[model samples]
Each structure stands twice: as structure tokens, then as C-alpha cells.
Target: MRNLTTSTFSLSAFLQRTQGKKVVLIYPWSNLKTQFLSSYLDQAKDGILYYRVPGETVNLVDWIDGMLNEFRTVLGDKFGKKTSAALAERIPAHIGEALASDLGAVVKSETILYLDDLDQINFDDEFNHWAQAFVSALPEKLQLVISARMLSRHPWDHMVASGDAVVIGVETRKSAMAFTVDTDDRPQLECYAFGRGNILLNGKPVTTWEGTLPRTLAFFLIDHPLVTRDEIFHAFWPDLSVKDATNVFHVTKRKVNERVTSRIDDDKQYELTQYTSGFYVASEKLVRHYDVQEFQEAVQQALVASDDRREQLLYQRAIDLYRAPFLQTVNQPWANDRRDELRRLYAVALTGMGRIFLRKGEMNRALGFLSRAAREAPEREDVHRDVIRLYLEFGMIHEARQQYDVMEQALSSSMNLQPTKDSRALLESIKARS
Candidate 1:
């Protein structure tokens, strides 16, 4: 494992730190995106490139014109010469050949060429050809900064391979992280406690659990943030006396931390399970991603979203994160209770998505999602009615009747009650339509 790189949250810090590299690919991960970038760039003498032109498409020449104009504005260009270049892979060695060679010779101090939203540019090979030429030919006086939410590996694959370009905003994950990167500031650890519980350190999963108790202890700290020492004792060692449990718990916690630390390549130690203020919590210093935290946050945002499209998107994001039942493998009593709670929320999310689709006139997708909700939580009468209505709207009379029967059975088994008057009316209509 290479040494983990650290970066400050300020634009000045980032520019000063990464100025040596030719191409810096930045991801818009934070909320203060456009405004933050614009404010900082206004203070610097740099070449600007924007990929927006309302009600019209921008071609290669337009982009080049904008960039050259920016360079002139910043560097005070003395030459007005232009040269023609083909769309072939090969381009001249110097920056824009004759035009940039003049600029490079005059530049005393280094400057920046900032490209905003290069991802949004129109798909044109000729534009890409010139873009590649500009990057490859950059003199030591100027560095290229491409700020994009996403960037495809095109001509860049070679530049990155040759160490001429560097990508700043990226997380190394999966088998790909193994090859070797000189520096990275991506999340060094992440735990997805939902579905089958798993832990990853330095982009590699710690797949083996040497003991059951250690694994369960790890989940306990993650599942219930700020867990009390007493609660941990009660959950894992209720039968054992307090004196005995405390000793055992401490030993187990240390083992879990050691196992977690061993997997990471960093020489500096990190506490996977941090104890603070009479409570046990995950480490605050360690950079990490928790899927459970993301799922809950998305659901909370979707519930309050004012726009329908935004609401639908947030709910979809939350639903997609739930790959399976929470903690499916662990059968501990405490795990079971938390699992049940998360499962209920999952059903609610599914029902919410089903109704959202129904509102958009997508009856088939609505029915499919509503049916899954019914399976996970049969007691939801509203979900059943929504599914039955979609089936009836699609002229599936028999299926509607079958769904009504399932709803009736669920209510009978769970609550010993009949469907409401409004639902019964829908049932009677299903029979009449048949």
C-alpha cells in the first residue's frame, strides 16, 4: 500500500499543491461547486473554457477561439498567427505549434488553463482531436485543470500512463487499486453493514472473519453509533457477570481493531472502533463511506423534496443502495431487531417509488415495484391497493382479484380485520369489471 495522500479543503491549497502536475482532473464532490470555483478563478490569471451556449451547439473552432482569447487576455499575446491541424492521432510537439510556442517563450511564471464541465461538451471527434493537441503541447509555463463530474479515458489513457497527466479527484476501488498509484486522497475505508455485512480498508475488502464474536462486535459499533459500554455488555454477554463481560468485551474489541488495522497498509494506526464520552463509535479521523448512513440521508431528503422529479430521483437512489436485507447473515438478537427496523424502511421506500411511478403513468413498473413491496411487507394495505389498481388499470382482472385476496389474507393473519370501505369498493369493482 502506497502512502495515503492528504489534501486541504481550500482552492489555494489545492492549486499550490498540484501545480507541478500537467493535468488535474477534479470531481465536484462538495455542494459549494460552481460558486466556489468561479470565485477562486476570478482571482487568478488563467485560461478559461466553458461548455455552455444556450440554444446553440458549440464546435471545435468555437472552443479553441475561446481558449486562445483567454490565453491572450492572461498572457498578453504578441503574435496573431494561426495554424491548421488534421483530426488524425498525431499532432505537433509544441503547445498549439507556432501560436503557443510564441506564448510559451514569453511566459515567465506558471499559469493555469481551467476547463469547466468538459464532460458536458458536445460529442465531436474534431473537437477532441484539438483538445488532445492543446493538452499534449502545454509548455512548462501552463498547467491544464479539467473540472468535471466525469471524464472518459480517451487520448488521456496514454498521457496518464506516461505520467504527464495526473487525476486528483478519484477513489481507487475493487481489483483496480492494486496496480499502483503514486498518491491518492480517496476514502481509505468503507463499511456497508446493509445486506451481507462487509468491511473494506485501502480499497481492499477484509473478507475473512477469524471469529464470530469479533465480527459481531465490529457491526455493533457501526450499527449503533455511540453505543454504551453497558449495551455492548448486555448484547454480547448478558449471561456473564459485568466484571467478566467487561474483560471479554475489551479483549474482543482490541482483536477487531487489530484485524482491521492489519489489512490497511498505512504505517500510522487508525481506530476502527473509537471510544469517546462513555460511548463507542467509529473513528472520526478515518475517511470512510457508510451505505446505511447514505440510505437514511437520501430517504430523509426525498421525504421533504418539493419537486416531484427530485423526490423520485432521491427515492430511487435510496432504493438502489439496498442490495439485500440488512445483516442477512447475523442472527444475533440485537442484529435481528436492527435488521427488522431497516427492512421496514426498505419496504416503505419501495412503496414510495411504486406510487411515484404510478403518478407518471408507468403502470407496469408501478405494479412490479408495488408487488415487491407487498412481498416484503404484506401488512401494507395501501401498497396492496396500489398494486391492485395498477393491475386493474392494465386490464389484468384475474391478477387484481388475486392481489385483493392476498391483501385480505395478510390483514386477516396480521390484524384479524377486513379491508376498509374504500378498498372493498375497489375489490367489488374488480369483480364487476371481470
Candidate 2:
């Protein structure tokens, strides 16, 4: 009989048991799916039933069919001919007559159905039906296990509501650290928290700096922790003369030293170390935390995934990982460049998301997402191009023309280049429509 309560520890123990029972393991994100499946398979008994849901391409029927075929292939090798064939054929109707008769004949043992990447399956009415059917079809001695990112408002939620399902929550806190400027001028201590809110320092509740200019500078320094003071001064005072900016930097450095240098050990270097022309913070000791690293890793992973399933999962993971803009409260020149880089990457991610939506025939959502991306990165001609193309495809002439104008101005001003042939053609097409 299935237990109605599930925890990671309990599930781990349950999977290790030799007694065979029907088990379903549902995985959400694709990146972790294979790793989890391999672990489970290691503990699985011989003749264990295994089913893998393909990436987003396969529909429910195909997914089910594929599972039965795989079961047949694996079970046929182990359980001999008769049992393998029976199990494969009865897979589709496991809870009905076939499984019942087969179990009666073969001293019913455990059947494990591992469903990796359950999140790929859209949680619609049809999915709920399939889930219910699959669960009810299991034998009396069967144990089912489903794992996904979250079951909230999902078909799995309904399963939990009913007595047959057990729900378990895994609290995975992304690692993060907070930095406070000590009187000693060193990035002395680190703070950790569950999320991106205020970071605690030495058991005292500390809020992230809120003032506009100071916060901006702080973020810039954090983003390019190794950036030279000259680079930062240039970024902040781009319109000012270099000599003037250097003078300001010297005064500013003195003020920062007065305020933050007291806590630093005389032997230890300051947070902003002196380089020949300017200063830089060492990357190693910066008081940052886990979420930032997680997001950066996810972004790199997504970029590597390109257009594959892993890429989609990585994009989602990155989105979830990013809580706020790079040092949301900070505005210094160092911060601006980092913020710009992040915004650029964010626009690219949005464009990728729009393409996925477009492939799914979700035209409205695709256009909306692309439009927002374009707006966020108005200076990016590529982003505008994407918006224009999507709008043209959707027959939104006015919107397309507006994007063309924005693109034209942005390219001319920011890049000192005209729109490309493709962009011009798109603009002409919209103009013709108008």
C-alpha cells in the first residue's frame, strides 16, 4: 500500500526497498532530471519498470507509448518472453483487466514508473485525466512517486488533495552573501539569507543601502569588483574632463576611507585597492552570496544549451534565480556597466522565450514578450528587429512601424550606424501596409 506522506528521506528509503511495487518519479526541471533518474535507477531492482517523458516535443499519447515500448525492451531482457510481453502490452491499461490478470498469474511484484521531466507536460485538463488514470491503474501493492519543481495549483495538487497522493517540499536555498563596509575599509565579513532581502551582519539586522548615488556606486563596485577606480570615475563622469574626474576620485576616496577604513586591519588591504591609475576591489573577498553565483551559473549554462531543452530549463532557472537587478540600490558607473550587461543578457533571454512561444503558436504572448524586451533595450537594434519581425508576422502594422522608428533612432544615435538591409526591408513592409 502507498504511504500518503512523503519526504526526501522517506522517498529515498522507499526507493531502496527490494519489494517491487509500481512507482512513479516525476522530475520538473530538465537539468536535474537525468541525474535524479540515474540515481534512482541505481537503486532499482531488476525488472523494474522505467518510463521517461521526452522533452517538450512529444504529446501525452506519444509519451505513454514511448514508456510502454521502453518497458518492453528492458523487461523483455530480464523477465523472459511471456512476462515482458504481458507487461509491455498491459502498460497502457495497467490498472484495468490486463495488469490484474497478469499480476494474478505472475505473483505480483513491484513496478516502478519513473516519469522524469513532468514539468514539460502542460498541466491542463487532459494531463489531469492522464495523471488520474495512471495512478488509479496501479495495483493494490504499488507505490507511486512523483517529483517536480512545485505542485502548486497543478494537477499534482489535486492528487495531494485526494487520499492517494503524498506531497513533499524540498527547501533548496540558493547560497548568497551580503557585504558591509567596515571601518577598516575591508570586505571583512559575509552575510547569508534565504533570499535577496536585507542581509544580516554579525547578528545585527542590516538593510541594503538605499540612497540613490551611494547605492549605484556600491552596485557598480560589486558587479565589477576588480574594476579600477579610473574606470569607475570615467563611467560616472563620462561628460567631465579626465583631470576633473581624477580630482573628484581623490576626494571621494578620502571620504570613503574616513567612513569605512576604521574596521579594516592595518595589515589587510582596503576594499578598493590602489592600482597604478585607480583602485579595484579584489574579487575573492567581496561580500556577495549564493543567488548571484547561481544566476551567473544558470546564465552561462543557458547560453551553452543554445536552442535545446537544457537551454529552456536553464533560462527558466536563471529567471527564477535573479531576484533583483544587479545591486538594485546601487547606481555608480561601475554598477551601470554591469547593469547594462545584465539587461543585454536579459533581453536575449526574453527573445529566446518569445521564439519558444512563437513556435508554440502563442502569437500574442510571443509579441508581448518581445515587445517588452525591445522596450527594455531600446538601444539594441537586434531587439527592435525581433519586435518588428514578430509584429509583422502578427499583422500589427502600427506597432511594427513604431519599432522601426525606435530602431532607426537608436542605431543612429547609439551605434552611429544605419539599420541593416533586413531591418530596412521589415520597415518597408510595415510602411507598405500602412
Candidate 3:
């Protein structure tokens, strides 16, 4: 018995559990729900006897006949036509015995009797007891998967007691929380902005931000906690006049609010609160667990560290959080400043790590890190100089000369500047060593 939720029911997890037992998948009826379940079962590897309970009222005997008709259609000769005919002809009293005998012959390897919307069939106490007995009598190889809104008074307790059933509730889905983000009923929305900007709520991506403007707006809000109307206008709609921008702002904001509200079920909605100074920020009540926030905090920690070991650890922590340039896809002028700032931090962190390793005479490791630092900031003469010095020390004179050439070209092309006197002197020294 799986108490299905929007997040918990995926094809892979469902397939994994139907190994060698009867299964029940209960859910409310909707066109979407029906399509989802049917599509999933259709794609399932094993052959399944899929039956949707009929709407008209029928006796238990007729219900059983209808179910067998579906099975006969799917299994054909394997269901044994003679036996099926015999069972259908039986009186209500002897129907259970006939079914128990016939079911054993019908069940085989990789066969599933999938009953959709079991709750649709109005089950009285006698019908419920009969269902329990009939299911128990089926071969172990035959798997039963049931879907319904509620079982109501089904004899599930007895079935479960005999180790023929298991119940999966919302809490069971919660146990697999590591794979999902809780957006429903949670106080805060977790926004991940490392590689690309993904505004996640309840472990799912929000549909509101699928549009470029809306997504960019979300990133802007998360990045700039308190943004005035003018700031938003300038950042996103620079070409528009203040009045026109204001119109766009309200429309977009409403769309964003609707998206957030639809996704999150919290009483206190995820919102952008307006300050007295006419600045807007994500609601104070809605806590944001942003990757950029963590990255910045790590860098700040590294800056204030009292010890070299502590500084190294903090810098590495910052680097790990910075998967790439902040909002790499959002090519906005406002993003450029922060992007450069983070790039600098990354380069500095790598250089500091390299220098620490170099001082300890770990030549190869030091060079590896310095090489990364140089890649992060190709025009940073200091990082390149260190790499050149390490290459010379390691007797890789050609590599040292190559490093010097790269620095010289980058400086000349980007800044129209030459390498410093120290850099020139280092190249001369590498030349003499060669």
C-alpha cells in the first residue's frame, strides 16, 4: 500500500519494488493521474494484466468475471479458456474455490495483475473478505498492483499480517528526502545558483522561471536582497522609461508570485517584500539557502582567518561552492562585477594553496595548483610568475619559457602592458638555466 504523492511516484522506484510480491498503488482519480499510471505501466518491462474497474454496479460474481475477461484477453491460452469458462459458470458459493484453483494455473513468471482505481468498485464487507482470500490464494509468482484513492474497509490488515503487503506513506517518501526538495509546507525556498541559476522549491525546479526575464529577475532578487524599483528597471529593462518599466515590473512580479504560490503550500507565501525605501527583496519570512550566499560567506571567512591552515581550509570551502562564474548564463552588466570578484577570489585561493604547498617543498602539487590559478586568471602576472619559477626549479626550462610567453601575450593583448621587471628577470634566469 503506497500512499502516493506528486514526488514519490516515479517509474524507477515503482519498478524496483515489484520484485516478487503483490503491490498496491493507491491514488485519487484524475485524467492526468490516469494517464501517468497507464503510461508507466505500459512501459514496464514485465507483462501486466491492466484492468480499470467498470462504473456500473455489479455483483461480486460479475466483478470477478469482468476481471477474468481482462486477464483472458492478455494471457489468452495461458489463462486456460476451459478453466475460465468453468469458473464463470460456478455459483456464488463455489466461486472462491474455482478462482483459487484457476489463479494458480494463470500466474507465471513476470506476470502482474494491475488493478487501477480499486476504490471505484464499491466493496461491501463480504466482497472485501473474498478479495482478501482470493488474493492470498494466488501464486507467489503473480504480483498484484492496485491503485485507488482509498481502500476504506478493505481487508488489508489481514493481508499485511500474513507478510503479503507493505504500506508506504508520506513519511516513507520523506525518508527518501535526499533525492527531493520539500517545497510544500516548508518555510524557505532553497535556491541553487552555482553552475546555472536554478530556483528550486520542494526539490523541484519552479516553472515560473522558465522564461528568461522571470528567471533573470529571480537571480537578481536573490543576488540583490534589497533592490529598488529603479535598480530593477535599470538592470533588466534599461531601454524603457521609468513608467514603462514600472508596468513590466508589476506584470512580471505577479507572474513570479503566482508561480511561487502554486509551488509552495506554506501559509506565509514566498514573496518579494517592499521596504519603506521602495526597495524589494525576497520576503524576510522566506529564508533562502543560496549557494552564492554560502560562497561569499566562505570567502569572507577566509579573509578573516587568523591562521594559514584555517585560511586554506576556508578558501577551499569557498572554491568548492563556486562551481562556476555566478549566474554564468545571465549576461547582464550587473553580473560582471560579481563575476570578476569571484574569479579573483578563486584565483587568489588557488595561488594561496599553491604557495602553501611550495613552502612545504611539495613541488608537483604546488605546480598543479599554480597551473589552475593561472588558468583562472591568465593575465595575473603573479600567478604566471610563480608557475614559471616552479617550472625552472623543477628543471622544466621549456615549460617555464612557455609560461612566460603566455603571460607576456596576455598582458600585451588585454592591457597593452609588458611583463614587469621581475617577470623579465625570471625569464632571463630560466633562459640561463636552459
Candidate 4:
């Protein structure tokens, strides 16, 4: 159904995909972000400044100050002797623009500021505001390439919509320019709905879906253990009458099975999806493995895990399995609704990670996981409380206050509601003790 081509996630490939975008926000869930960048940096060794955020709190102002000093040392020859070495008492208000201009004037080509492992940086609203502003203020020749782990608290949706930014690894409808190995012997369909929807039939990649509707339906069926025929009609052909919808649904459903059966060279009879008791489900004859299914199962297992270590392992597995949102490219109401549910599960997985690490007395790891979870699930007041308490534990009084404000703002903005009275009490009590 597709070309047998090998597409490596190489440096040149990345450059070509991200050519015109000034701001590159690698989606947070991807494990490939750092690996792709690392190889890219190794190959394209010029015009790129890679700054790996330390595994601790990062003051934006301090980081910028330090960066500017490093820049002077590297590009010092471009500046005159008098301007080559100077330490400032305070960072200028318009540091991004000024630095962009100064650097733009001297550099022969465009420069990329690659901020990797952004999860390490404490997610305060003030810092987030500055980061967004800094990105917007960059010159044409200046680029802000941040890791996928960049906090969602920074609103870059507008930038992405305007074509000023591009989120890498979001498309998967076409052939991925590669060959998949048949590693697993079992005849199962591997539906990876994270990052993009990648389907592997019997360990061999299934590139084409015949049509979009077929692919969408396959994923939907794979997602739900069982669905009523009427529900499928509503999700796919809501506007059509029952008679017309049923006709269309049968055609689409047939197409899905055909596409999968076509991919397999065997003559073994298999039905991709089955209908029984007025419910459509994945066929018992055909094994199906959806990443989202496993991801949710892992979280569920973690909840009832017998031991802390096993619980921690299960949570980590779920967190790792959630490489991205469910069906990123699919924008239908059903897909969107499923994506929201998966994201909430992911948020739960993150919270579980934080709690497990907290039990282990790994405060920094616990704090990072909790902060990420807080941002992921803005309305998760319990997670927000954990972050606030963690900040207090670290003696970050100001940070704790800022985190509370973030929760208040998020709750107000998203749902037009306030934090629970208990949340307020916890912060106040913690502060009083501190």
C-alpha cells in the first residue's frame, strides 16, 4: 500500500522539516526529541548553541546573564576590545531583542538557541512569561529550539497557529520513509496512537490506511473495547440518517479490515473487528495491541500495585508509554474527546511518578514529576498542592507562593473556579510554619 523506503530521523531530515519555523516546540511526550537533536547537533556543528538545563532550579535572568557572558567569550573577536569583556549589574528589560540584534549583526548565519531538558527549570508563571516573550522578541536570524519537555504553561499555540512555530513529529498519515522489522512472531496489530498514529501489523509497519476514514475508524475501534453500532454511527456519520449512516459505516468498516488484511501476505482468515450482541469489538481471532490501552492499564495496575517498587515501576511504564497525546492528527469530536481522556490519564501517571519518588525521599525527582503533572492537569488541585508543599520543603518560600498563584490563575482561567478551601489552608499553614 506504500513505498518501501527507509527514512531515518536524521539531522538533514529534521532541518528540512523544520526549515522555515523560527520556534521549534518538540512535543513534550516524545522520547526522540533529545536523540534527534543530539545527532543533529553532532552533524551540524555550527550556528547552534546547545544549553542543557541543569537538573535543578533555573533562574531565567541568571541563565540569560550566564549565556551572554559565554557568548562574549565565544564571539568576542567580533566585538571591539572595549566591548569584549564587561559584566553588567542587571539584565536589560529587552534582553532578547537586544541580544538578537547584537548577535545578528556579527554572526554570518542564523543562530539557534536549543534549550534541552526544560523540565528541569522550575515552572513559575513569571519565568514562563519571560520565556514566551523572549521567543517572540527574537530576530529573524535568531531561533528558539526548545525540547519537547518544554512546559505547556507557556502558551505557544498562537505562535504555532501563525506559522512562526512548528511542532515536530505530529504527522503520520504518509509512509514514514522506512522499513519495519518483523521482530515479534505473534500476529497482532500494534496501534501506537501517541505522537502520531503508527500502526504495525505483525511487527511490520502499515503505512497507508486506504483512506482517512478507515484509519480513524480502526483507531476508534481499537481504543474502545466494545462500542455500540449506533455510537459508531454517531461518531463517524452523525449528520446522516440511520439507514444512510449504517450503509456508510459498513463500507468504512469493510475498508478498515481490507487495509489490514491486505498488509498481511498470509491467507489466514481473520476479521479485524467483530460484531456481537449489538456491540462491535476487536476480533478475538486478530490480536490487537494499542499503546493507549497498555498505558491506561499500567496506570490502573499502579493504583492497585501490591508494593511501592512495583507501583513505581508500573507508573513509570505508563508515563513512558504515553509518548504523545492520542491521535494527534485526528481532530474529530470523538478523537478530541478520547485525546482529552488519555491526557488526563497521562497526568495521573505523572502524579503517580511524583508520589512514588516522594516516598523514596527523592525530593528533586518528586518535584519535577509533580510540577509537570500540575501543568499537564491544571485542575488537579491535589497535584498543585504537592508542588506547593515540595517548594516549601526546598525552602523556596517565593516559589511556593508563585506556584499557588499559578494554580489560582489556571483554575480561574480554565473553569472560572477557585482552588479548594483546603488548598488555600495548606498553603497558608505551610507558609505560617516556614
Best by TM-score: 1
- lDDT digits (tens) for residues 127-159 of candidate 4: 555556566666777778876333463467777
Where's the lowest-lDDT run of ten residues in candidate 2? 1-10
Instruction: Sort the predicted structures by lDDT, highest score first.
Output: 4, 1, 3, 2
Residue clash pairs of candidate 1 = none
Candidate 1 vs candidate 4, lDDT winner: 4
Task: Give per-residue lDDT, candidate 2, residue 55.
Answer: 61
- Name the runs in model 4 displaced over 4 angstroms: 1-186, 266-269, 426-434
Model 2 C-alpha lDDT versus the unseen true structure: 0.51
Q: Comparing candidate 2 with candidate 3, which one achieves the higher lDDT? A: 3
* Structural similarity to truth (TM-score) of each candidate: 0.62, 0.45, 0.56, 0.56
- Reference-based lDDT, residue 22, model 2: 42
lDDT accuracy of residue 78 in candidate 2: 36
Instruction: Tell how far residue 281 is off in model 1, in angstroms.
Output: 2.1
**Which tens-of-lDDT digit does each residue in 49-168 have in candidate 1?**
332222232555455445555556544664334432321223433224544555466656666656654655564565456557667667887777775434667656677787777665
Q: In model 2, what is the error at residue 174, expressed in angstroms?
A: 17
Query: Candidate 3, residues 324-350: lDDT per residue as tens digits?
Result: 777787788888777887787778778
- CA lDDT for candidate 3: 0.64
- Give the least accurate 10-residue stretch of model 3, judged by summed lDDT: 170-179
Report residue 399 deviation for candidate 4 (angstroms): 2.1
> If candidate 3 were superposed on the true structure by all CA atoms, what would the RMSD be?
19.2
